[model samples]
Target: MEEFFNELFDYNFFCNKQLIEACSDLKEVPKESMRLFSHILNAHQIWNARINGLESEFGAWDEHPLKTWEEIHYENQRNTFEIITNTDDYETRIDYQNIEGRLFTNTIQDMLFHIINHSTHHRAQILADFRANGLEPVSLDYVFYKR
Candidate 1:
């Protein structure tokens, strides 16, 4: 389970890095793309904080500057890797509150999967926004990354 999650995180990291690199080359990122990507980074950090039992330094929809995206992404990845490495049981239930102040419990593995899946969901939105704004979107399919 740990190995599986590590692989997923690695893939997640790659996809985000690719997107960040793609955006860095642009003169100006589309507003929606920036909003979606910022949410991606913020949500990842928030999930990491929840798993680590620490207060999240970011909100789910917070907009970070373009220059800070890579740094926050790296920190989020590092924290997740540490959590994955140190976790003894992937099925261990975590109690956490959502952004809406609602309490919920989820297993470590489930939460980890959610983080990756959530990022993919928003990244697709950003890609679509890129295209709608006359910008080329980078290919971020998992198969492409694997190949």
Candidate 2:
């Protein structure tokens, strides 16, 4: 299971790097693209914080400046790898509060997978926004990363 999760983290990092690079190339990134990617990075940080029993350094919708994105992203991925390597109980339930301050509990494994699924969902939306803006979308599909 750890092996599976390590692969997912690797894939997420790879795809995120690709998307960020493409976004950086734009003379002006679309507002929605910026918002979505910011949300993606913020959410990843929040999840890792939740698992580690710490306060999130970012909010769900916070807009991190594009200039600081890759650096922030690297920190998030590094923390995620640390979490992945150190976690001993994936099935243990984690208690956390949502951005709305609603309390809930979910298994660590569920949260791990949710992070990947959540990022992929938003990344798709960002791609759609890029296409709508007449920009080329970077290929981020998992199979493409596997090769």
* lDDT (Cα) of model 1: 0.93
Cα lDDT tens digits for candidate 2, 65-102: 99999998999999989988998999989999999999
lDDT of 1 at 91: 92
The residue pairs that clash in candidate 1, if any, are: none
TM-score of each: 0.98, 0.98
Distance from true location, Cα of 131 in model 2, Å? 0.5
- List the pairs of residues colliding in candidate 2: none
Off by over 4 Å in 2: none
Alpha-carbon lDDT, every model: 0.93, 0.94
Cα lDDT tens digits for candidate 1, 33-112: 99999999999999888988999998889998899999999999999999999999989999999999999999988889
